[model samples]
Target: MQACELNVIKYILFVFNLIFAISGIGLIVAGACVLSEVGEFSHFIEGRLLAPPVVLIIVGCIVFLVASLGCYGAIRESYTMLMAYAVCLLIILIAELSIGIAAAVYKGDFDSAMKNIMKDSLHSYNESRTDRLAWDNIQSKLKCCGVTGPKDWPSKTRPLSCCHPIREGAAPPQEFHCQDAIEGDQILYNDGCFDELKMKAESSANVLMGVGIGIAFVEVVGILLACWLASAIKNKE
Candidate 1:
């Protein structure tokens, strides 16, 4: 009976260690990816601006240590080590729930506001605004209103001279005779892009938070099951 209980405990620890190790690997990989491109990406988006969370790095370290302990516990039939592993898992669960709750609280407001901003921005600088007019003369043609970069840009500088808008190493096709670049127009367009980007980012975060919280809950249940299984095996023995 004692041997059977020990075996059940060993199996549980094995599973615990495996799960934590997998989670650690995922965190490290995600952190690396975000860190690699944060600079360029951050220029265009809000959440992209910051470095990866320090908490993630800390959690990863904790997972590594606890998973090692779990492996040792399983190999040696050590109840104390298994208990420690369970405690660490509980801490991880609490952190996951906290983060998910924070995200949930702010999600609705952020989403609605972003949608409105994008819609307005799309209407204002749609790049096709100038194309709406008809020109009466060839010189007037030089000022034809179509964005410089789009397919409909005037084929000849005579009908309308297209001046491609050059921005930070990226030249956007100029519509022929684009109305003078309005003051602060770039800021507005960029803001709209940011709003759209954040909407996508938040949606992805919502899914990640759901998955993470779900996993944490499962881990807690798993820890309990491991204990129960060990107890049951001992009784049968």
Candidate 2:
């Protein structure tokens, strides 16, 4: 090729490198935001901060690395480097497309399962809290039943409200009244509630894993495309 032609090719490569760099930086920034739970730049549609999974972090780093190679490859006019980056990118792209399809099929199932788990956890928390409150009420009510109208109580049987000659001596009597009914409730089932919470946590974990995997795939494909295109310039020359 003529000197002028080579210069033109270099210029073209430079332009491509600039474009790829910009795109790579954008993807890396987005991934970082998601991983760190930073700004709303990469949040779920629900307007909530969503942390990206470890897979996404890996993918983002790979994209930035390949993109950096693209810049260096253009500067050095190194076909081998470009090709290496292209191959790496292509592998990731293929994986992303394949795994993304699989994930798409099973993602809904995972989401549904997670939702059920969360619902169960919430129910458990509510039920447990209620039962605990009831248990306390029952204990208080028993104390009330133990106390008589200060007339029929035995000497040893003391009322919860008033104990004459307190340890502190001459302290005012404290009144204790139970609000629970005498007999109209079943025992609290806190175990089931706790179990549900565990399930909910597990489900959330699965969702995050899936999201990270998916994002990793995207970054792979994007980087591969840029690298492959950059290498093609050499073949054309």
Candidate 3:
């Protein structure tokens, strides 16, 4: 490879590294947002489902650090640093690919796994205060009653959060309200929490999967660039 071509490759890698670094920062911010939104219930969720965001934050930081090395190597035209960058890129590529494949495979069992987790959470609703609050929040946010339905509750009484707030000029129920409602007419939210939560989880997983695949493609390009640049430098030397 000619010196001029090597110089061009060096600049290309530098630009690519800059873009990759920005992507890493974006992932970190997104992961932090997810963690913040989930709040208390995050602990109760399945590890497989909860882990990706955290992993993204950690991996994103590592990628950012590695991108710096690539940028510096490209600027300095240092064979040693470029070689090290290539090795790091290879490792990141493998890790990202493994995570992407695992995520895809895990989607198959997501529904069953989510159902079991929600059931367990419901069973512990009264036993653990944390679980109880988490369930209440889930019920309120999703506007759902119980795991399967209102019947899941032994008393057949729905939490206050399950009830939609009374609209202006609408008189409150004369007799039974959401809390004591046993019949379908009185129940504020009859739908189960599992389905709503499952749908949300599936949607989130799809988005993450898409993002992972996109990142993997970029990593592949990075890996190829790093290897090619390293080879060209070696040949020139």
Candidate 4:
């Protein structure tokens, strides 16, 4: 390549590195948001479900490291730095793609996993304090009763969280008590939480997938640019 052409490529790589850095920040932010969003109801989600977001976060950090190094190599016209950047970016690309695929696979099974975990949480609601709090938080936020319906709770102690939000802190009124009264007479089991919580989980998972793909795209481009620049530097040398 001509000197002018190599200089043009160098400048392009430099600017691309800046954008790549910003993208790294974006990845970390998006990943954390998704992680926290789904993590709130972690009790109902299998531990493995958190892997996608966490891995994305790591990918973002790696992007920062290699991307900054890429800028150094590209701007200084250093063949060695450019080669190193290309190699690191190639590795990062593979990891990002792997995590993206894992996320896609996990998303397909997220619903059933959540449902099973929720059922287990429900069963432990009476025994585990953490489970009780999780159930209460989810029920109150989503305005849901048991996993399927109000009948899913223990008959004697359904708890007040399953009731209306307005009556959440207050004692249940005579007209809408949560006791083992006829279904028509009580207000606790009005809705099931499975659909609502599952939707939230699925949305978060989708975001994770999108971010993963985005990071992967950036890495691929970075790898290409680094390799091209490295070759140009070598030819010039």
TM-score of each: 0.56, 0.46, 0.87, 0.88
For 113-178, candidate 4 gives per-residue lDDT tens digits of: 878888888888889999999999999988888887788877677877877655557763543366
lDDT (Cα atoms) of all candidates against the true structure? 0.49, 0.45, 0.77, 0.82
Clashes of each: 14, 0, 0, 0
Between prediction 1 and prediction 3, which has the larger lDDT?
3
In model 3, the worst 10-residue window by lDDT is 35-44
What is the per-residue lDDT of model 1 for residues 1-237, given as tens digits with 9 covering 90 to 100?
Answer: 666666666686677678767777666555444444332333223352232233455666676776777677667655566566677778887886776566567667655654454334334433544322221111122222222122322233212222323558775545433434332444112122334355446544544554466557656765775455445544644
Model 1 is weakest, by summed lDDT over 10 consecutive residues, at 131-140
- Top-lDDT structure, candidate number: 4
For model 4, the superposed segments whose C-alpha errors exceed 4 Å read 106-110, 167-176, 180-186
Better candidate by TM-score, 2 or 3: 3
Which candidate, 3 or 4, has the higher lDDT? 4
lDDT (10s digit) by residue, model 2, range 23-99: 54655555554444322111111112232233444655666676677667756767777677667767656655565
Off by over 4 Å in 2: 1-3, 34-54, 126-237
C-alpha lDDT of candidate 1 relative to the true structure: 0.49
lDDT, candidate 3, 14-88, per-residue tens: 999999999889778877766565534564467777777788788889889999999999898888998898788
What alpha-carbon RMSD in Å does predicted model 3 have with respect to the real structure? 2.5
lDDT score for candidate 2 against the true structure: 0.45
